[model samples]
Target: MAEKTTSTVPKGQKSQFAVPYYEISYDKFFQFGVSVDCVVFGYHENRLKILLIKRGAAPFMGMWALPGDLVYPNENIDVAAQRILRDLTGIDNLFMEQTKVYGQVDRHPAGRVITTGYYSLIDIAKHDPHASAWADGVYWMDLNEVPKLAFDHSDILKDALQILQQRVRHQPVGFELLPEKFALADLQALYEAILNESYDKANFRKRILSMNLLISLKENQKDVPHRPARLYKFDKQRYDELIAKGFSFEL
Candidate 1:
């Protein structure tokens, strides 16, 4: 029998033929598996930290790694990422964005595997993480103190951090890593921690205030050493309205 072909034609148009399935090769493509890695960043104790898992399986068993897993054959990659993150970290419903893809031929020893990296920021105090699935243990570590990771995860993490740093300068994403109501000093500290640099206090405060994204809560910090500072909250409603009117947020 001749190889099978498929076609679709519009009214009064000639049919266009698609190459026969048997004429194309899929064996090489089938050999590779797709996976996702999560780079979950949080701010605590005036430092930037990342969530990591202690692996329980081979190919780097007992080593520290970003929570990750292979995608099921029928699963959507984005859904797979969310599932793997929740399965390993016990934190769900947090927004995450794709950072990059790692596809070196030898990145995985067990087989040919490619992985996409995802990153998200969260308030460390809001949720507690427990290890599950292939993760024997899970905890937060200071970004500056991260250990050598399994696979190419170290590279994946570095790229994610760079993306986070760039994003904070152009968006309000860093606020996700802070408390809902925070002092201006706390906000500045969080930004410094992520960027690994200090900003001039006067200029930084002026620029941030001029953006009109923060609402003074008419509240002050309580139970703190030295003089208490004023507290503010991000005005998300105003931000949405401004965005609709073509306002650009930049640091």
Candidate 2:
């Protein structure tokens, strides 16, 4: 005969049945936690920068790190990402794409926690970051000048950046970081900052103009040290139509 186990219901709770119960203990299952980290890339001063927050809590307190936090038990990963980013950085509603999962057994000092890295690009001048929650301060650091980061965030940033570079090369996602009206020089500089490479001025300008993805605004830079360059805006409507017809954007 199979042995029966006594029900371990709480004192205030009543058992549904009067017979002995057979319960499968869940204690033998592995317990772990999941978290989300955001790598927000922005273009500023003709350089690529990412948002970093100074930690105010333990397990790397006082160190600059990506805005991240533990995921709640009942929360979705994407929702957790948005919530965590808003709670720590005061920015919201930006589209973020998942990049990688860092699951080193000892990555987190607190416990066995796995973190998913998400990345997004934005116009730095548009969204102002305000640190809150466990973040003591928030700032943007140049990609090359980023100091050692907390936890395994450096690896996460690097992987996300690689994906960003690849995506930028194939898609027009870089426009998300540029002003609506911009000079070709501004566009080239943004690309260079992201790809970390320089292109011949004439060649780059000619290639971009030939694509017909830019609409001449008949406007020029108002105040500048150099000759005023004609401004153009990304022809997003045309781009969408072309993409529907199987046209791919290639840089």
Off by over 4 Å in 1: 1-25, 241-251
Query: Where is model 2 poorest over a 10-residue stretch in terms of lDDT?
Result: 20-29
What is candidate 2's CA lDDT for residue 202? 90
TM-score of 2: 0.85
Best by lDDT: 2
Residue-wise C-alpha lDDT for candidate 1, range 92-166, written one tens digit per residue: 887899999999878999988999999998889988999988899998999989999999999999999999888
User: Candidate 1 — which pairs collide?
Assistant: none
The residue-by-residue lDDT of candidate 2 on 153-175, one tens digit each, is 99999999999888777666445
lDDT of 2 at 193: 92
